[model samples]
Target: MRLWLAIIVGKICAFASRFFKRGGGSSLPGSLARRIEPHILIRLLEKATPALTSVIITGSNGKTTTARMVAEVLKHSGLRIVWNRSGANMVNGIISALIEKCSIRGRLCADVAVLEVDEANLRHVVADIKPGVILVTNCFRDQLDRYGEVDTTLALIRMALKDAPPGSTLLLNADDPLVASLASGSRCKTMFYGIESLDLTSGYTQDRNTVTDMNANMNMGMNTNMDASDMNASNINASEYLPHDARSCPNCGAYYEYSLITYGHLGKYRCPRCLSSRPAPDFPALNVVAQGAHGFTFAVGFEHDSEYDSIGASLGLPGLYNVYNCLAAIACCLLLGIPKMIIEEGIAKSSSAFGRMETIQIGDRSVLLALVKNPVGFNEVIRTIASEGSNKTLIVCLNDNFADGRDVSWVWDVDMERLSRNPSFIRSIVASGTRAEDIALRLKYAGINQEKICIEPDLDRALELGLRKLAPGETLYVLPTYTAMLEIREHVRRRSHVREFWRA
Candidate 1:
């Protein structure tokens, strides 16, 4: 009786969500369903498990991209997968996706389910749906207002891992200090993946160092600009930006010196204090070559699994960040015994997440959507544009909504100075959204010509002005915060005759 009741309620929630235009579904209904029918939904779904393996991908930046790659690789291995391709990582969204694919009788029919879960909600949803494999991409400081700090978020993720079933495989990035530290404590079988070599010129580097006095002044405004010296004094020191070279023993006071640095503090580090360092990975992608905006090429060792036979594969996403995501996916797929050829083919054909390097055709003009929510992400976007070798106009939308950090002060931390330093490549700059002026000010301080900067808080008008300023065959790059991206996509859909397939 209770099983039937929960199903009825889930269906009703699904119906209501559609009627009210509220995004709903996933284990959210399971929460309410559990109150009325404990264990019923889990037992029911567990009984109808699909033949395709289940994989859950989580992290701060690359969850969507990694999940898409894993799904593509599995598809190449002849398995059908049902995934939330629209970048919906919440509980209700996952449930809605499952409900959409499941029969009215409540049975999942796909061969596999590849889910991209939000880091914060991983604990809540993982308990309800025990995934067979968990892939953690990487952890970074994001949305300070919501996540508090990187350490706090990492602790929460650690607590969630405690509940993972013993047999489940944990795939982690060995390069990330925070991620590596967490994986060390897990008892479950773990597989680590990371960049084997450090490209110093392409990686992030700290210009200065600082020390923090934990007790000196906790009352400083969140937006206050502190130099590296002050940042270190405040205990907010920037770790080495190279991921591969970061090697410190968190357990002891000893430092693990890295032979190379990847990004941030992720790299080969050994604790001089404790004699502890990451063990060499069992499976690593070799011969990585950046293929510009089309992704990268690399070879996976097939000895671990015969399913992958191809020597090289290329991904369709843009930026070095996508390369990190692809590496994570390749590591896991190789462990799963996927064929090399299939992995390569899937990667070559895969597209990026919505509003994440997604391109659209507006009449004769091409618009590229790049989501920039934080300084780190924004810096990468700017770097990508710098490497493109073409002069272009930029439409940057800034919003201070709850999801985009109520404090837009982080903009000051960004190295917009680089953009200002280069005037030849960027012809015009258009800023829009509630915090448009704030972004404009940052650009001006970075040395951007104030004459070339245009601010229009109204998104539609900003789009018109920005588009009008573009020359034939020229591209307009759109970089927007979370809410701003949604608004920009809506405006594009309403005005332009072109189809907006990359909707959030």
Candidate 2:
């Protein structure tokens, strides 16, 4: 009876939230519902449709985009999908999504629940719901003050996987050593996905520093199809490319040997002492082609299973990080027995999540919004910005709000120094947010001229200044932390008539 009341109250609150323009009420209603019924999530899951298949996606990065991709593909394939579209990924947010989908009598109307779970909260969600598929994108050093070390994040996720149902499948990233390491202890079935070869220097305009960093880490002599011989460590020092946390193998306390380092310690790696290595990926992305601000096209290889050898896929979202997200989504759909044709079409049709490489038009200028909370994600946004050719206006908003991680020190870990490599690509920089001065300082230290940097603590003023400075035909890239994204995106929506994030 308490659970039933919780559902009724939650639905009413959700309706009021939307009607009053209280910003989606993505967590508040569920939080209130949970207070009334402590085990509301568990009880609600018990009443869920028997045919409903829940998919929980969690990691340091790519959770929103990956979950959005999976949900869009499944929905395109005609399966009803209930997801937290507003980027609310916590336990309360998930409960809110479920409550929104549940009818007045407490019946779930969906066939699949594609949820993006926070790394620390994974254990709680899994305890209540045995997901049909658990997809982990990658684990990196993020929210250190909040989540401690990357190892703790991995351990928390590992603990959750231990509780996963027997029949569930774990789709993991083969490139990330920490993520791939989870398969070793899990009782549930596991599937891995990764990239076989990446050559980003050609066919697109990109951050020369980013491309150089990747190429310097890889053997330039390798052809489009890489082999064991190409894995020789003659290209560059792998340590320089790896994040401070991922330099060593997770299995043993030994330094990892890598044949390739694809941005921040993710790539082909093996441990000599423990004899542990990156497991062969069941679904491998081959011949990845970056389309600048447009996204990527690659071939999905199904070597072990399926009828077709490989299927061509494309995503409208840009960056190499998104390629991994796409692969994880494709792998999850395939595991659920979705047809290859449906998967291909769904991928092509899938769009970016809110504030995740979302583009808005302001008169003749194109403005791109990307949320940056951590080092790896921030660096990828920088790469995307640099990749969009030259003469671009950049606005970087850094907030230390509770949602954005109180510790602003993580900005130092980002590869801001690379921005100095091609000083001409960025026409001007507007530093805005609670920590605007901090970002301005970082850019100055990165060798950007003081003349090009403007510190505007107010987001609205900073956005106006950026647009005023933006030349016709050039793109303005706005990168902000989580809370900052919400604030600035609301402003953009009102001015440009873009759909509200919840509606999108």
Q: Which predicted model would earn the best lDDT? A: 2
* Candidate 1: residue 134 Cα off by (Å): 0.8
What tens-digit string does per-residue lDDT give for candidate 2 at 88-169?
Answer: 9999999999999988777889999999999989988886788989999998888888888888988999998888888888
> Where is model 2 more than 4 Å wrong at Cα?
204-244, 303-308
For candidate 1, lDDT tens digit of each residue in 331-428? Answer: 77776667667777777777776677777778888788888987667867876776655567889899999878898987876667656544676788
What is the Cα-based lDDT of residue 394 in candidate 2? 88
